[model samples]
Target: MAKTKKNVNEMSFLDHLEELRWHLIRAVIAVFIAAIAAFIAKGFIFDTLIFGPTKPTFFTYDILCSISQSLGLDDSFCFNEAAFEIQSRTMAGQFSAHMWTAITAGFIIAFPYVLYELWKFISPGLHPNERKHSRGFIIISSILFFLGVLFGYYVICPLSINFLGTYQVSDKVHNDFDLSSYISLIRSSVLACGLIFELPIIIYFLAKVGVITPEFLRKYRKFALIIVLVVSAIITPPDIASQVIVAIPVLILYEVSIFIARFVTKRQNSKALKNV
Candidate 1:
């Protein structure tokens, strides 16, 4: 039997649109199911997950304190309190917040299935060899995403919460944080880091398509470092120590992506030569 290769580029406009519609429909269904589950788990979602990092007794704080003691460093990780209280300013605010929170939670939980669906839609258009080589797309992308989310939650969220929550202008005023503001920090940190962690995957495909070169990455590495630090600073605390910590992992990922692209391009060239 002939391989059923569908050349999507050769399809008519309506056909292309129809194919895209199915991919989107599947992704939406996955998200909806995950959201409904999250909505029903109000206890675990709100108290355990959302408020976990903000507390002094959170696991991240405890682990950091242990490390600090081992290193003979002052208890930099110790926080007596966040010094802020969250509240709703209007009617329906709490209800609106709950609905939106569940939706965001749904998207996060459904991320892996969402990526799998997207890969399925795009893979049919790839050459057979390309598809075979990228067979681990769903697994690899999902791992990267989870790593990013963990980094955001354990590193970024804690730092931001500690800094902003503790900062005070005057003794006359108290910190009464809005519910929306609290949720936005968690949402942005998790989502932003999740996307940023896909640098390797993005660079891999770009290189496969001849859009990026390892040599180019090496040539502009110093510039890339500057950009990474700037991004880290924008998202993290203004302190040099916090910025450095965030930038280090990202820089490592960028360097790793360069190596991946080099290996991929070399493999592609070798295959071409063998064919010739």
Candidate 2:
């Protein structure tokens, strides 16, 4: 079956801007609506999810404890609680953090809708076959994003909290962490991982457009590892184990991206042969 290309509506630059403006407006509305819901559910957002890693009874801690026991290691993982105390020093610190956190959560939750709006703006220019092949773009991207978020929240964030919350240079100096700083760590970690996991999707598109190839990805594999390690080091605590833990998934995603590029190139080659 031959795929038909849709006739793209030609428009002036201002008209294109108008179309883009509408898409942006709709995306913003989606985020706003989701943010309102997040604001309404304050207890769940703050107490349950946000503060989960700070408690000793977090699921990750228990799993670590079990692993340590099974490995005949010391009870280092069997800590009673996180050492740091979170505080809002400024008068508007708590309120500001609450509002921004709600907005960030909204963006995270409405990610798929946001992607859909972006796709709508771009899809008209794509061939019908391209549009058809990319029908699952929003869903696949959303799943990868959420998985990355979970990995950050469960693995990376916990490791960071455990290490930083416990480390002490002196007994006299208390770990009185600012509320904003604490939330920022969580936000950056989750969002960074979410973006990182989109590497395969990014590579797929780049390959499709002939901007990058499987060979390029392969040639730069070692360099990519170095960059990933550097990124992992920046987001995670200054520990080899923490950096390695965060880098592992990212490295896996890179390998998957190489395969995606190869698949896209192979398909493009086959299509070219058919056309010839």
lDDT, each prediction: 0.87, 0.88
Model 1: worst 10 consecutive residues (lDDT sum) = 1-10
> What is candidate 1's lDDT per residue for 150-252, written digit by digit as tens?
8998989988888888778998889999998998999899989988999999999999999999999999999999999999999997887679879999999
Error of 2 at 210 (Å): 1.0
Backbone clashes in model 1, listed as residue pairs: none
Task: Provide TM-scores for the models.
Answer: 0.93, 0.94
Worst 10 residues of 2 by lDDT: 1-10
Candidate 1 accuracy as TM-score: 0.93
Any runs in candidate 2 off by more than 4 Å, and if so which? 1-7, 72-78
| Candidate achieving the largest lDDT | 2
Model 2, position 271: C-alpha lDDT score: 99
lDDT of 1: 0.87
Q: Say what the RMSD of model 1 is.
A: 2.8
